[model samples]
Target: MPLPRPLAPTGRVAVVAPASAPLDPADAHAGLSVLRERGLRVETADPAGGPAAYLAGTDDARVAALNAALARDDLDALVCVRGGYGVLRILDRVDYAAARAHPKLVVGYSDVTALHLALWKEAGLPGVSGPMVASDWGVGLDAETEADFWRVVGGDAGYDVRGPGGEALTPLAPGEAEGVLLGGNLALVTALLGTPFLPDLTGAILFVEDVGEAPYRIDGMLARLRLAGVLGRLGGLVFGMFTGADVAPGRPTFSVDEVLAHYAPSVGGPVASGLVYGHVPRKSTLPVGVRARLTCGAEARLHVLDPVAA
Candidate 1:
């Protein structure tokens, strides 16, 4: 995996709305301040307030804003303003030649996942899944979340990330394994299953998270991965927060935990839940296409085995 150069404390970064517009101007501004507080030079690529039909802007507009950012020579990285439902539409519009020509970290989660996958396929560079200006940063990040996010993006040395439940992981499937860290939001991951954008997860620690999905839908996506033979080649599975996935009484369905319990064991490698990376307030960041290790036991922790950036 090719890691981009690690962003320095005062590195230049651009914020762009590649998916949905920031719902609130203040939230977006506040989120940008978070990056500034991290000692970064943050700039907005385009007006995040630009409106469209459920998009931050028209497909061309969004693509152009992103391309402009990617083409810049002074930027050290790019962070998204928000993620909703437009990145896939502009995924192919990315200036791959420019992106590959000047590799740097691109950060976001949720619908921005499509962009990350597209970058991997098109630019052959990995991305960081962390706080977005309108979401995680605007809401507020706990110390653990903020530290992990910066450490993954700014530092050169890899570190260990223990789940919330110390001593032992919340749910552990015995064994230890290492592989390239990959995957993000469950919905986006499933959406790209049959697409050229999806990377080959031959032996990757596939971490997944999602929100507002029912238990059955979550199970369905996981089932799709399994049926697609995607899970069979995994070195491990890191189950992150699946918020709003509680089953309602109306439908007869297996619980999210049940679904994971059923599949994690079958992966035949370390499996654990409660990773602090998802659509949660206090969440950590993951570097896609980088080496990671998972040790399942009383002292289980996901260790970033390699630098995500130079």
Candidate 2:
């Protein structure tokens, strides 16, 4: 595995919109300001054209901008502006050669998960599955979230995964396992099933999270993974926040917790929840493809075992 160079305090970062354009341009500007305030040089990659519907630009333009950023020798990192949609459409066209040749930290989540998985599969490059420029920084990150992001990308050796309030994770199954940390948004991970982009996650510590998915949908997705032999091959399993997945009042439905419990037995090893990651303001910056250890019992603990950056 190739770890990108750790970003320095004064490193240059390219901001690109590989998914959706910022709903408000002010958010983009504010996000850029945040980077500048951090004493980093920030540059925005302007695609050939303007937004095409919901996407930042046409597929060709978005891919071109992303490839250009990847090929840049000066940039220390590339951060997506936001994650709405469109990355899946241009996955095949991404310049994986550029990615391998110039491995740099790419940061984003949600729709960006597809890109992260594809890069890892095609280029053996690791990435920070953390906050987006416009989506998080523009809105302002909580202290913990901001600290976690910098700690990972800045080449911290390792750290314990803690909730926003510094609470320990809740244990779902009693055991321990260690492996490379993989996975991102639940929906995106599920969508990549059976695709060439989805990496072989055998013996890997998979962490997943999502927003707005109902309990039944969560159950179905888990079922699909179980049926596909995904859950059975895991070294361990961790669940982040499942936002907006609560059961409606007076409705017949299992809670997200119930759905997860139903599938806990399918995992090959330890199981845990409340990882303090996902589509939330206060989320951890996880380095995809890095080795990590998960311990679950009375107290759940996730310890990243490798520096994300060289």
Candidate 2 error regions (>4 Å): none
- Residues 1-310, model 2: lDDT tens digits: 4679998769999998899999899988998999899999999996778999999999999999999999988999999999999989999899999999999999999999999999999998999999888889998988878888888899886688887678688889888999989989999999999788999989999999999999999999999999999999999999998998877689999888988988988995899998889988888888998899999878899999998898
Question: How would you encode candidate 1's per-residue C-alpha lDDT over 1-310 as one tens digit per residue?
Answer: 3457788769999998888888887998888888789789988887344779789888888899999888887888999999988888877778988888888899899998888877887778889988898887877777777767778887445677753323235646888888888889989999998888888888788888999998878888888998999888888888888898776677788788887788886677888987867887776678887788888877567888777788
Error of 1 at 227 (Å): 0.8
- Stretches off by above 4 angstroms in model 1 are 47-49, 163-168, 297-299
Q: What is the C-alpha lDDT of each candidate?
A: 0.82, 0.90
Q: How far is candidate 2 from the true structure (C-alpha RMSD, Å)?
A: 1.1
Q: Native-vs-model 2 lDDT?
A: 0.90
| Candidate 1 vs. true structure, TM-score | 0.92
What is the TM-score of each predicted model, taking all chains together?
0.92, 0.97
Q: How many Å off is the CA of 21 in candidate 2?
A: 0.9
lDDT of 2 at 270: 93
In candidate 2, which residue pairs clash?
Answer: none
